[model samples]
Target: MEDNKVDSKKKRLNIVSAIIYIPMFLGMIQFFFDENYRNDGLGWLLLLTFWVIRNIDQAIRDWWDKKQKSVLFDLLLAAVVLVFLIIRGMEYFSS
Candidate 1:
């Protein structure tokens, strides 16, 4: 029973992660190809906001489970993503 519960929880988390990531992936693709979308910050902002909100639970769980190593990795990943998003936003708004 305990194993079943753990398996189910993992499956649920996987589904949730997919749900959150797939749209972001699509949005990034669109932003790359669509000139109008690239010039608008709202879409990027919405995607970034949704990503953080959706992944916060997983991020916290990862931090709690692995302590310092996972925290460092998470922070690094976040910094990269944030930098990319900020750069894109700046490019969009500056033009």
Candidate 2:
């Protein structure tokens, strides 16, 4: 049935998202234990960027499934991520 198809798609999406999250989680653990990442602010910033991007993707998917999407919330998330990327880029270039 169509319902089964939709459920399967959702399950697949969740599986894929979990797979993507694993690397980010491992990276954070590595970042914490690694002295080099501690010394380099850029590394920390890059890790944060990846985390934000992953969350943004999830948010977009969630909004897509809803009948009434909140444009303001999505736009705010985009803006914040943009500002974060800009700051991280500046830090990367400065260093």
Best by lDDT: 2
What are the root-mean-square deviations of the candidates from the true structure over C-alphas? 4.6, 2.8
Runs in model 1 lying further than 4 Å from the true structure: 37-68, 75-95
Clashes of each: 0, 0
Each candidate structure's TM-score, on Cα atoms with residue i matched to residue i, is 0.52, 0.69
Candidate 2 structure, TM-score to reference: 0.69
Candidate 1 local lDDT, 1-95, one digit each (tens): 98788668778878887897788777766765676854346666657655554546557667645576776666667666777778877876777
Q: Could you give candidate 2's per-residue lDDT for residues 14-81 as a string of tens digits? A: 88878887877776667667777544565576576675766576566766577235545655676787
Best by TM-score: 2
Worst 10 residues of 2 by lDDT: 67-76
**How high is the CA lDDT of each candidate model?**
0.67, 0.70
